[model samples]
Target: MEHEPLPSESHAEVRIVAATPEVARRVAAVLRRCFASTEQRSYPAGREGGTRLHLTLDTARAAEPARSWLATSESTDQDRTHADEV
Candidate 1:
């Protein structure tokens, strides 16, 4: 499906579907874990279809950068390292 960006960064939408409720739940759980989404609501799909889930991602919450990773190291290392190591 085509995606259009919403007017604000605080809100985002995703549609999830599966052949059965159990599978749908599993997929939704995995998505939530990976993307930190919250389920706004869900409903049964049209004929010959399974469950459909409407989820929202709170980008405002996710936008905060992790400062610990951004802090510069105070010590310089003599050992050489490859760029790919990071």
Candidate 2:
């Protein structure tokens, strides 16, 4: 089946498939720390009984540490580029 694309580049659909629900939720929790996200919806992944979780993230609305981290990363990349030219 064809899935519809996200409304914009700043929005993303995240899917976490893991061997257990706890693992899936753990991953989702980590993402939630960095981005604004919808509540996760959980489903059974396969006959063997893994978990599949879905959530929507708004990248444009980054959380505290992530915003700082991204800014620092950009600066670091620029510094590296300038250094390489020297």
Candidate 3:
């Protein structure tokens, strides 16, 4: 079946693959707290019996703290990389 195209906006599709459903759900829960998202869809994945979860997030609606945290984290990572090269 052909699914409808996602709306054209600041959004992201996230896929999480983990050894167990609990782990995938835990990660999804954290994302839900940070952004507005659709209900997650789950599927079986890999020969090792892992779980795959897919959800679409409206990044334009990201929580204030999450946006600041991501910006800070990116700068911190870049600083660490430059330090390592020095």
Candidate 4:
């Protein structure tokens, strides 16, 4: 299927473009997370490896923090029960 990723051997290149180092790192992190077992590379290091290091516009989604217990119905019920018992 087109959705399938190419084999490691088939992947012979890496590219990066970003406004700063932080952006580049975030991009690399996301690529690594999404495409398991793929290497990310960097040009400036002049060293080659399975993992690539480069800059790119990040399109990765950030995980939102979990809501506090007080924000949920479970906590509300607990509070009501405690008030009734008092």
The candidate that achieves the highest TM-score relative to the unseen native structure: 2
- Candidate 2 lDDT tens digits, 1-86: 57676567878888888999999999999999999999899999889899999999987899988778766764434455344221
Pairs with steric clashes in candidate 2: none
> Where does candidate 2 stray beyond 4 Å?
68-86
Tens digit of lDDT per residue, candidate 4, span 44-70? 432432333633222222222212321
Worst ten in a row by lDDT for model 3: 77-86
- lDDT by residue for model 3 over 1-86, one digit each (tens)? 56667666788888898999999999999999999999999999889999999999987788977878656764434455334221
CA lDDT of every candidate: 0.62, 0.85, 0.85, 0.42
**Rank ordering of all candidates by TM-score, starting from the highest:** 2, 3, 1, 4
Off by over 4 Å in 3: 1-7, 70-86
TM-score of each: 0.53, 0.71, 0.70, 0.33
The pairs that clash in candidate 3 are none
Q: Give residue 72's lDDT in candidate 1 (0 to 100).
A: 39
- Provide the lowest-lDDT 10-residue window in model 4: 58-67
Backbone clashes (count) for model 3 = 0
Clash totals, every prediction: 0, 0, 0, 8
TM-score of 4: 0.33
lDDT of 2 at 6: 50
Question: How far in Å is the alpha carbon of 40 misplaced in model 2?
Answer: 0.7
Candidate 3 vs candidate 4: which has greater TM-score? 3
Model 2 lDDT, residue 15, Cα: 81
